[model samples]
Each structure stands twice: as structure tokens, then as C-alpha cells.
Target: MEFSIKDIIEAGEGYHIEFKEFLDKSFVEEVCAFANSGGGRVILGVADNGTIKGTHTDNSFRSRVQDSLRQLQLYLDIEIRVQDNLIIVEVPEGSDKPYACSRGFFIRNGANSQKLTRNEIIDFFQKEGRIRFEELRNEKAVFDNDFDERAFENFLNMAGVSRSIDRMSLLRNLDCINDEGKLTNAGVLFFAKDIDFLMNHAIVVCVLYKGTEKVHILDKKDFKENIVENIDNAILFVKRHTNVQYKIEGVQREEIPDIPDVALREAIINAVCHRDYFDRSSNVLIEVFDDRVQISNPGGLPSGLRPSEFGRKSVTRNPLIASLLHRINYIEKVGTGISRIIQAVDENKKSSVEFEYNSGFSVIFRKLDRTSEADLGESSEKTKGKNAEIILEAIRDNPTVTREELCQITGLSIQGVEWNLRKLKAEGKIKRIGPAKGGHWEVIDYSC
Candidate 1:
């Protein structure tokens, strides 16, 4: 590619561009960094302040520069072009990533080349999918030592698999065990008797705060069970804390959670399935505030996925874990979780869900407006007089109906149904027969 030196100066140094007054030994590090990250062009003969000092160019000088890049372990084809007095080196993004130099492993951070620490290098490999966390065998994990037979049996039942296949055979078929007979990390997470003991960061932490900020905690629960159990329990915690309303359709009443249950469930499942298992410091966090509920996991989106293809693309960081979950019907499809979450929220007419991707991935479900809840409550009360007539008619139709049954028949909460019943009895419209347990509702005067 051709470049005008004036245009390069105006562009300055950034994530995909760098400026160097002259080529030095450090130019090799710059080349490696660009290849490791998004590919960028390093312009020699350009000063740090965008001053084009220009470098001495000859056939021998170009050969010497090429020789320096060859010192890298992996051979990279760098596009070297001499424009006027400036030398431009265009390095394409490495297909085989985590490129290194004799100095150390380096990556482009903003405009600079930063050498990675030992742990950072390992994390980079995992993020690039070069190393899968689920496939790695846990040295301390033994099938007989910590495997929960009951949990495994429950999973088989849910998955509709027969117990005719022995446990070891089933495990092997599922890729939960390696040839050495040691359980893989995926197996330990899914069937371990105590995941908290086996892997501390595999649990789910739920917190309910009094307000938006994390100042005062009203309730908190750390679920340290198998992956499925943790997901279920985390959802249960949210349901207990969030609001619920009764929706009456004819004679049947449905309890609708304030935040759509399907959306919340999908978020939780996505978090557990795609979270970074390599990061042992942080667990999946579910935080509920007065305004919103945020669910976050350690890892962001998979490496190759672009922002535009976020919900549309299907990339599994832990294929083994995802496959196991899919077998048990926890996940319906590979890449539909995000879309399903959005659809659930929209169908419920709840506030839109927000997705954030940084060092970690987060889904925030906004709560319904307080004013809207008040309006709904007001509307329900206004229709209560008519609802009372419906209740009376229902009691006449079924004299053996219980209060709980009235709740179902009338499309009201237990408390709402009870209040209506009490008002009817006070008006001499209905009565109860026998004990509360076996009692039936009776119409007294049969007047609305």
C-alpha cells in the first residue's frame, strides 16, 4: 500500500498505527505486537511528535531490517515499503496468535507494545481458543472421589437417557473423562459433590441491594452446587425478590414475574456456560438493585466474534460444557441465547435488556417503572368491584372451591383473592362450610 508522509503524520499513533523516528532492535517488538493484536502499520522515519525525520534507505538497509524480524520464532511476512525518505512496515494480524520475540510475549495495548506476564500469556492462549479449559483434565478430580451419583442420575433422567449404559461408559461417551480415567474440568464442574470445594470460582453469587448503588445489602446468597443447580437457585433467588402479578385468562390464573423468567433464565445459563473457568478469582455475579438486575460472568465474548455479530454468531469457549448442557436441554441452541433473552423481555413488555462486553460479559435487565406498577395497581382496584361479581359467580358454579382455587379462577393473587372474599362475606354474599382445609365456598344471598 502507498502512503503520503503528511497523511500518516496527521493519523498519529493509535491501536493500529505507530510512529518511529528510526528502525531499532525494538522495531522487532513493535512488529510482533501488531501481529499479536489487530494488524497495524509501523512508520519508520517518523518522530514520536509526527515529525518525519526520515531513515537512511538502501538495499542493504532493507535487508538488515528484514533480518531483525526473522529473529522471531514464527516467520511473519511484513510488507516493507519505502515512500520518499520514510520506511513503512505493514504487519498483518497473526493467524497463529500470541506472537513473541526474544524479549518476551508482547501485545498491542492502545498505542504501545506491552510485554505479557506469565499468567497473562496463559490467559491469552485460552482466550484465543488455543487451549480449552473444559478439555483440561483436573489432576485432583477422581470420578469415584467426588462424583455425585444422584446428580448424574438426575441429569440422565432430564436428558432422557437410560441407565442401561454404565456410569463410566456414559461419562466417556460424553467426553467428561480422558483416556487416563481422570475427570476433565467440565466433569468436575457438572457432577462434583461440592463444586465450591473443588473449584471455588465456579459458584454463583447473588446479591439484592436496597437501592441502585451497592451500599446496603438486603439479601445475598452464594450457590455452590453443580452448574445446573446453581443456575436454578440463582433464578429462584431473583424470583423471590422481584415482583409478581396475577394474569387472569378465563378461569385460569397465571403468575407473571416482573422481570420475564425466560430472559433471566437464559442470561444465567449463558453466564455459566460461557464464563472463563480459567479465572479462579471471580465467580459469576447476579446483582439485583431497585432499578435493574445485572448478571455478569468472568469472560467477555469469544475472541473472533465482532460486535456486529454478537447475538447472531455462535462461538463456544467450552464446547464440552456447552454440549453437556445441550444434551440435558438446558440450552436449546448454540447461539440463540441472546436473541431469546431479548425476545422474552420484549414479549413481557418489560424494560429492554442491556448487554455489556468488557473484561467480562454482563446482561442488565431493567425493572418496570414504579409509576407503571402504581397505575396497574390502581387499574386492578377499579376493576375489583367487577372482579367481585366474577368471584361470586365462580363460587356459585363450584361450591367446593377453596381460596387457592378462587385465586386460580379469578386471576388474582392469594392476598387479592382473600381480600375480595372477605369483602363478599362482610356484605353477606358468601359463606364457608366446614374446616378451612376441606372447606368449600358458598353463595349466601346470590346478589351482586
Candidate 2:
């Protein structure tokens, strides 16, 4: 294959190479090295003068490379080709944990190769999952407008900022609104009520498809509103379709809730905060399938994001929007929604969070039916329901419970009990019997 010098130049840092006389054991070692790192090209049969001299074009040369790969512990998708008498083997970095050849584990260090110690190797694998999604920069917005007064105020409210905050100061802190009054893509996304009208590319679309087919539209809503409203509206849209149960406490306790509102809210916030606003045609899509729900946004993973890095690193396609959302408490500061969602899903003892970066970014929340012991197998012995058990125990103690009764039983405030009741009812776990005077708590699912 022909290589573009201009593309190589534009690709800038992180791309590396090693030219060889012919296919050899060391050459195979280099192939594994490139595969372990963030991937780069290896050219052969070319002189240092940038002139192609060609390589041993026999099938053996290719066989040796393939054999070396098989011998290595980790296997990944590697691309091998030849162009202009040069043997170019493309190694895609493997994500199946630590990979090693005869030299043990290795990593690319600023255009040089370095051997990884046991600790270093462990750290590398850990970091693959510890990536955050908020640290990405919007270079295009470095010199653009980055603040909207209403967006800033709304963000502060969502983030739980009680005190008054300066709009310019907040923008400067987020690095979206520069001193020149130019807005970053983030500023446009967060503040502009009609971002789609202004940026066109910043719109978020939430669609509820009848099936996988795109031709039939069961229900769809486009969010051209400001980023904050877009996030809230999208979440409400999901909640509109989502259901949950209520678990009544008393002599015969029960668990109910078709779905968790918090889970839906988190999914919506994540979709809005991390979406690739750079893609013009595509918007953030929330497709509710019969068995599973898929939340997708245009644009593949961020530059430094990998599948394993799903919930770890802070990367953002629209950094400004993320920053504002962060301040407003829509998402956690360090990008902890993924872990929180995992925790919540585990608590429900159902559902699995599936992440994909193909074509566009997608997070699929599957609807699970069972509460298996294996769901908490990681820590099976631990008490499963602090929240669920506490509430259930209180209701078991008293069936004619009021908000005050719930508070006294669960040691929570009336407001807290009300919140939990709302959540429980949303989950389909419980139902109120009658009027406040003669009303009783009705447990929905006695199975739990």
C-alpha cells in the first residue's frame, strides 16, 4: 500500500516506525511491540534515505510474521500489507490486558521503546479502565464564545453551586470561553438554547424506534434547546417510557419497580454530556428496543478513548458542555457516572451496561428480568440491599405506614421517604391503598 507523507506529517505525534533489512525474529518482536502500543506502522525494505529497496517478497517472510504473532500470549487484529517494494505491517494495539513477547511487556515512550516492569505493566492495564471523559479539549472553540448567562446559571443549579458565580470566571475556568470572547464548541453547546439553529452540529436527537429498522418511526423528538434542557428533556423522555416498581414495608413486604429512574437519568446525562457534537447529521439517539435500550451519539470514541477506557478516563467531544454539566451536578466531577451506573445496575440485580464505539458511540442498557445470586457474585457474601432492605424491613414492621411512618421506620426524613417512595412507585414495586386517612401501603411484588 502507498503511504501518504502528508498524512503522516498531519498525524503528528504517537505514530512511530522501525525499518528492517528483512523479516527476522527482532522484526517480529517489533510487530508485537507496535501491537501493544497505540498502534503504528512498520516499514521494511526501505533505506533511511526514504528510498524503497524492497524486501524478501517470498511467502516465508509473511509466514514468519504470522507465526511470531501466534506465539505471543495476546492476540489482536493486525493488518499486514506491501507497497512500493516495502513490507508494511500494521499492528493494532491489543486491549486484552498485558501482552508480552520474549522481552516481557513493552510500551511506546515518546517515539522510543521501553520495557515494562511488573508494576508498570499492571499500571498500564489498570489505566486502560481508569480513563476519564472530561479532559478532552475543543481546539476549534479555543477562540470562540464560551459562555451564556442562562446556561451558566442552570449549570450552577444542576451542579449544586449555591453561591453566585461569575460567568466569565466560570468560562475561563472551564477553558471554553477565551479572553477574546470567542466561544468554544463547548460554549455553543452548553448555553445556546437553540444550538442546532446556531451550530447545527450541536443538536441531540432522541428517537424511540418500533424495531431496529430506521424506516418506521414509532416516536422521535429533536432537542434543539440549550444543552441543559436537552439533557433534562432527554432524561424525562426516557423516564416517560421507563417504569419502576414499589416495595411496601410491613407484615408482608414486597419489591416492585419496572425500572430505575436514576438509571435512566444517568443514561440520559451521559448521552448528552459525552455525545460527539461534531457530527452534523447525527444527533444523540435513544432507541428503546423491546429487549434492550440503546443510547447512541454520533462520532466514534474520543482520541484517547478505548473500549476498556469506557468509564475511567475523562475525555469529551464537547468539553464545554461537559464542564457546564459537571458544575450543574448533571454528572460527577471526575466522570464517575459509569461506575455509579454499574453500581446501580448491580443493586437492581438486573440489567447490563453495554458500550460500543463502532460507527458511533453507544451505551446499551439491557432490561434484565431476574435477580440472580450470580449478579452479585463478585461480592456475593455482602449484604445486597442496604437501600432495599432498610425500606422493606420498615414496611414489614408496619403496613399502615405514612410518610412519617416510613421516616421513623427507615430513619430517614419525610422528604427522604417521599423521594424513595416516588422511586419505588416508579419501579412498580408498591402502590398506595386509599385516601391519606384510610390508606394503606400495598406491596406489589411479593416475590422479592
Among the numbered candidates, top TM-score falls to 1
Please list all clashing residue pairs in model 1, or write none if there are none.
none
- What does candidate 2's lDDT look like per residue over 136-204, in tens digits? 244444332433567767665665443433455444444444445556455666665446556665566
- TM-score of every prediction relative to native: 0.56, 0.46
- lDDT leader: 1
Candidate 2 overall lDDT versus native: 0.59
Q: Worst lDDT window (10 residues) for model 2?
A: 6-15
| Deviation (Å) of 226 in candidate 1 | 0.6
Compared with the true structure, the alpha-carbon lDDT of candidate 1 equals 0.77
Task: Please state the error at residue 304 of candidate 2 in Å.
Answer: 2.7
lDDT by candidate, in order shown = 0.77, 0.59
Give the 10-residue window scoring lowest on summed lDDT in candidate 1. Answer: 369-378
lDDT of 1 at 174: 58
